[model samples]
Target: MGQVHQHVHIEWRGGTCRVKWWSGEYHANGRKRYESKGGFTDEDEAVTHGLDKLYEIRHGTHVSNRDGATLMTDWIDAWLGSLDHACTTERNYRSITNRHIRPFFARKTVSEVDVIAYRAFKKHMKRTLPSSYGNAVMILGMILDDAVPRLIKTSPVERTKRRGKYVKTHTRERKKDVAPETVERLARNAEILLGYQGYVLVWTMAVTGMRPGELYGLTRHYCYPFWPASDPQQDPKEADRYKDDKERYGRDGNRLPAIRVERQVQFGDGKREFFPPKYASYRTLVIPPFLAEMLARLLALHDYDWVFPARMGGCLGSANFSEDYWKSISDGCPERKGPRIRRPLPALPAVPDFKGKRMYLLRHGHKAWLDEDGHSRFAVESRMGHEVPGVEGTYSSVTVAMERAIMTTLQERWDVAAKDGWGTPNG
Candidate 1:
């Protein structure tokens, strides 16, 4: 057993009082943690500071005066290494810290940071674009938030007042959504440009609200045509077990086919690979009958594990999909007036809303469709692979009624698109 030790030391020197303490804790290497705070003109102030330090130590929130002697750059490097962030997230954080945070606070001690210094940092960050500035400041705040109890006594980036009112250093911009009709038009055009792959990809994303990465990572094994009895929120083993069982199909004649969102293909560490979905976005989405039949045919044709593979094979990374396929279809749609590329495509009309928009807008369109149909917030969020937040998220589970409603809405869109001749071999 380790011995308990704690004490505060006070000293008076040339018209000033200095206070220090031994935190009664040992580092992993077995060194005692010592802390000190100076610049107290009064003896009472010095004692109060020392007592506060002792309190922090006792409560296990103490940051050593000696331990934080490392420069901000070194501290940040260590802090980043210690985090369990996803590869993509870690890469972004490192980029933000090196490019923005490090230049401003590189040589400063962690303990020396205060609200005033942070305010100056924000002013400097304001020179960049809003999105860039907001991301950098948010990353810095996260770094500082993690620094406390290890490298510093407190975080300087916490909310502060200006002119007796609270102010924020960053604001997240809202996602812009497009109409479902725009999605159908894009899908029809995609079929003309890239054939079956593009048609299915566009339609699925527009109706399912799946992120690009999640769609890229989809596999035949993860697609279940039946309802799962086990609680997906419980554990991975249970979820896996539920997915593998096939007898659950046709138990409820009205039940729809479901797709499990378990993994995402992301680029990191100099290569792209399949990993679990971001923020564990592991949930099941019920597909409409038209989509379910389409998927079944797609699987039967390929007989490969990946639902949507790259033209060359393997998982389709974002760059290849965005630049090669999406851009080609979106940009080339305005042209091609004559009966070129097999047959005439009913005088393909230019879509202004699609200009400069991203593939993610399809996902936003799916959410809009759900909202338009008056699906509850909880139901929509769950299908979109987002936690609803607060007590509602804790208690909420996707009900059969909610799933059926989503399925019916998506199926209705498919019926309209079919009548419009979407996915026809010849335009």
Candidate 2:
């Protein structure tokens, strides 16, 4: 039998400070749970503290300093909340944590968690979740990692060749393609819905394949060539020159070509004003003539620096065409009162099928059309925002010409009216 332990208690007596410690044992699940040795100022307070610790221990909570250590759920809440993640991302994180990490590790101590436990947890997750559970494990690994070396013993996540090891499989329950024809219809519809501002947002992403966060981060200073006397070459990267290239920052008293994609507004818990991008995702793209012209026009009208926004519904907020725009118009069209709004579409990577109503289809269809038109796979990948795999299966690099080609192809396939208007502001 292990010796009874004690807990310290502090109190004031007769105008003097007093210290008391208590000793006790808690039993649960037919196991003995002991607390540190001592005498407390009062038996009740000591017993309560002892019982709480015991309950935690008997329930499989182990490792030193267990009571205060956060569970996976707590860690997740802290992480997502602290980052001010996007609405979609926060939603996804909650779903994955509750559905994946909590049920298994809710009571387990961070120090007690190991690869074996992780592997088993992953398999359980795979029973219904995607093989992407591996990806989730990686994310979980990250949260725990940030906590260790400061609060806990260490992070249990380590190198593991666990991809595709899940017991379940994934089918495309969501649209993997944005559909080409949908994009075409949306482009045509943009004129009447929200006008150029809305069209620019959708068109820019479709043509550049930039993550929505990156797209929202665009600024006039980067696109139109304004030089802070402190850094002149800073704007050249607006071309998105090469893979290893970073946004031109303060240089040797001279700026370089650059596009700064450092911030964006994302819908999160409370509609975050702006947030940082994920790793390897903060990047700028060279604008094409067609897309650049759209930028020029949009820039001329807006007072604040951003092109995709008229947040106060300025000249085009109510008019901008996004998923919300496409869906609202598709469902309300009077013509739909006669036909079922058949939104037929070809597969565009990442956009879903709407059977001829919503117009994300155009973005996908444009990609297919471009592939057939002699565009390189790299170009297609850049435009579609699809990850490009390399020789060892690593992702390929993004380049300015590559991004430019995406816009060019999009113009040929969907921007028929805007095609004639395409050209650099300087050109």
Candidate 3:
């Protein structure tokens, strides 16, 4: 720790009781010395006052001092390193956290990132990448939530929300994964011999409405058919899942079935690992009926390995998978001319040449179906693994069953749309 020394001398400035003293550092590396505020009535008074100011100066952390290499920056590294997530995810944190939030707030200790700075950050993010900006805000809030108490500083962005129009460009908004129909067809079109592996992957997301990260994070061990009997795995999850519940089981001390979702596949750092899910979905992904069966069957047959295995049968980098145009690997899809007909979508999609789109359109379609069916936004939002709009009782209102219902609706819509040609005009 640094030391402090305060010398007081009586002085007069504008006929006031002011003390002359020096605080903090006595000198810079250069010729500049410590500052002097002259004009004090008595030396004792000046000395006493100077000591307090010096204490505040030496011990009182300057807001500016909090800017360089603080706990906030440290926590991000710790958090990122601990992730079992895919490469894409790690890359995203590095790119977004380091490039955007860190450079801006890395200097600010957790407490230093107040609402004003948060708002300003949000505004800046909106200008660069609206969706990513919003995500950054959430990540920032999450990282700080655990850090504030530890750092003894307040988290500025906590409970803050952005309102009014989203600053996304229309063209940018249009450019994401194409509609779900295209994604479905893309899956079907891949036509790999692995028994609808591509189809099921796409279908599961459409049906279950789980996020891509959730799907990627899955391990063979996590999926099992929900047989109520005493299995080593299934029973423990239900008991421990609601461990957070005060009632544990509610009035009857019972929770519906519990599903697990502990990991995610992210396209980051040119590699992938199983990272924690973006939200609560990381721990559990509530599933609908057909989906439970489907997941179970897939797991049993594949031995709980990656639902989609690379040629190497190891963890596949999300970025590499996406980059390789392996979106649809079913036997059904045929490549004609040059392109494989369907490439994983990153741009606002146009109709594909050979009839199939990318894999994400299904997710998009499911979201649409959920919204149309009058499912509560919170319920739908939860399934999508996104923050719900408005600060309503979203945290409290939706039950696991309701979340399951949202998944059910998504699957139903996907099945209907798939048969109907992915809600596209195909005869």
Clash total of candidate 2: 53
lDDT of each structure?
0.72, 0.52, 0.54
lDDT of 3 at 56: 51
Mark the regions of model 1 whose C-alpha exceeds 4 Å error after superposition: 1-64, 161-177, 224-236, 239-255, 318-320, 331-350, 389-396, 417-420
On the 0 to 100 scale, the lDDT of residue 415 in model 2 is: 49
**Which 10-residue span in candidate 2 carries the lowest summed lDDT?**
249-258
Count of steric clashes across candidates, in order? 0, 53, 40
Task: Give the Cα-based TM-score of candidate 3 against the true structure.
Answer: 0.51
Better structure of 2 and 3 per lDDT: 3
lDDT of 3 by residue, 304-395 (tens): 36765543455544445543544334223243343764433223223363224444555676678677778877766665667655657345
Query: Which candidate ranks first by lDDT, i.e. highest?
Result: 1
Judge candidate 1 at residue 59 and give its lDDT. 90
For each candidate in turn, the TM-score is 0.76, 0.49, 0.51
lDDT for each residue of candidate 1 in 171-252, tens digit (9 for 90 to 100) = 6545555655677677766766555656777877877889999888887766643234422444675765566433333225
Off by over 4 Å in 3: 1-20, 24-172, 175-183, 193-195, 224-259, 265-272, 282-297, 326-361, 386-427
Runs of candidate 2 exceeding 4 Å displacement? 1-168, 173-181, 224-260, 267-271, 314-324, 329-411, 414-427
